[model samples]
Target: MSDLIPGLPEEVARECLVRVGFDQLPVVRRISRQWKWEVESPYYSRLRKAEGLARPMVALVQAQPTADDAGPAVHKGSSAAAATGGPANFYRMVLLDPAEGRWTALPTLPGPMESIPLFCHVAAADGGGRKRLVVVGGWNPETWAPMNSVYVYDFLTGAWRLGEPMPGPRRSFFACAAVGGTVYVAGGHDEEKNALRSALAYDPEADAWTALPDMAEERDEPRGLCVGDRFLVVGGYPTQAQGRFVGSAEAFDPAASAWGPEREEGLVPDGASPRTCCVVPGTERAYMLHDGHLVARDGAEASAWRTVAQVPEDARAATTVSALPDGRVVVIGSACHGGEQTVYVLREEAGKGGAVWARAPAPPEFSGHVAASLFLEI
Candidate 1:
């Protein structure tokens, strides 16, 4: 029998191929048909994870300036709009390695239209031994209308494939979270701008969405977090209270197929909504960016929210707050909207007071407003 890969035993070659980083997967795939088949197979991703070779990556949906908007100062080969004549306000997915501080642009999402929607919800899912980035409903860039399109990008294949479109009416600004092997989406507004209570869960293996019970109340642009097995949908408002949101939050138990009663008191409190909250994995506490401070609450306790650490004065209203797998918290924001962006990492010391925020280096291209950010272990 011939070796599966060149000049090596089949078993040894497979081990080496699984260790290849996701960034180099595309190039590795082009090496040969056997190499491509091995990389794209479910067994490969499973082996990568089992061997502890998968790396953590941060993906951001960011706005990119067009050639005209960029003032005709084009770099040698770094302009997407200059080559394609796409829309002036374009958005693309950019990946960053927080440890290495390196940035690489992925292939633009393949869609009938050239532009990405506004306020799209994005989540990363590792299911069926495959790692994928899932982008849920958002508004049409050209018409400013709601869309139900669901797109999944496979890191192994370096390609984007459309998943089953979200069932029913178009939704925008929905809350989405990946728990275990499933991606759950809830809330958001419809075409008429009415807040929706509908929710659904998608299984990557099946490539289908299963509708879950509607939320107790209409919530548009709510924040979602998967703590343990429950998916919590936090503070968002109805059409009447569009600007002012309620302080309540609700939790959905997929196993029970029902949503718990909404807590009317201090789930989100004042000045903090779902968009400003994040949960650190393996911790029982949920953190929120509230009034220039980082606050925490025991998920088990109903109303015991307390301050954890003070956020940097400049990063008051952060656009994204993500919890790294290593228990570090990263906050990204700009002094002014779409102006110079700054990233802060908060690390907790042993027996020390609390986490102290330190500035971190971010790519110059990430200075634009971050529409969405997700942390994925690939």
Candidate 2:
């Protein structure tokens, strides 16, 4: 029944409270019972956004810093690395503030386990005011065997919970995307190393899985994106084709729970991995980074990727791209193969010209190989 703060107008008090940075929100809740309710209220988030205070947080499952770390590394040493199937699973989640160039790590995942599974699928979803990070499927750290595990992290609680394990045979390298609090997974190889076309949708809230129609192709290592209202599986090699990737892509309409006819409209170029393919949030625009160039998948016009910018010289070799909510992109990678990793922020020049890349200062610990990444505009 009290105003947000004693002596001030409720509106003025809210404006001050909302201006508090996203990182400080957790602490703000402990200030007072009324303050906690105000910030935790769903409308508080909308009001903060209206006041231009919401921040898009970038999260990465990056390779952990090792004991013998030189300055910045993208992989681990022989003994330390080999424990997690080379440099893949030996990673921990890190958070980066793209605008401020700040780096921090997420809370440790549950269990005695120190690292995430190798090649795990990571996705972020903000539904009903709950910002959650979902990590699913990958090879076991010690045994290197395929796992159907699922883990969910709630930003509000700053803790992780092991969700229901993925149903069916364990798989690895699958395509995954999050939409409406549900995570959709398709393709990847099974425990016996067999490619799969099957797909499933997971509701972390219910801890349940719903089987969807199998994809038209037996994609081995496809990539996924949630573009608009659809989930797209792009560019994966069939079991018979092996390493020869196809340019075709498949789209799944969650509303109808059915896949559209497979299309070959250049989802990814032939023989290239869609590993670098991504969709920028807010803009909801898709993009692909291949060779040394960044291409935007033009949705409103041609439904194709147009060259937007060239990858920064330092990040050309092993690039991983995650876009801020405003569409400003942050690329992290090494100059050459197995080289020191670094950060670069990219912006578009005016007049539909091109892009500019600025080197961002990244702490040595956060400057490493990015196994998986996503952005949550919370």
> Which one wins on lDDT?
2
Please, what are the lDDT tens digits per residue for candidate 1 over residues 1-378?
A: 457776888888888788777878989988888887888787888788788787777788877644444444422122344455634456777786777777777777775454556778887887766778888878776566778888888876788888888998888777788887889998888888899999999987689999899888898878888777778888888877885777777888878989995465747875456686887776657777787777777675646778878888677758888777676777888666656667787876647767787887764544556677777888
Over 4 Å off in model 1, which ranges? 6-11, 29-37, 40-43, 66-87, 262-266
Record all residue pairs in model 2 with backbone atoms less than 3 Å apart, i.e. clashing.
Answer: none
lDDT of 2 by residue, 16-58 (tens): 9989877677788888899888877778878877877777778
The count of residue-pair clashes in candidate 1 stands at 0
Candidate 2 matches the true fold with a TM-score of 0.89
| Candidate with best TM-score | 2
What TM-score fits each model?
Answer: 0.87, 0.89
* Cα RMSD (angstroms) for every candidate in the order listed: 3.4, 3.5
Error of 1 at 245 (Å): 1.9
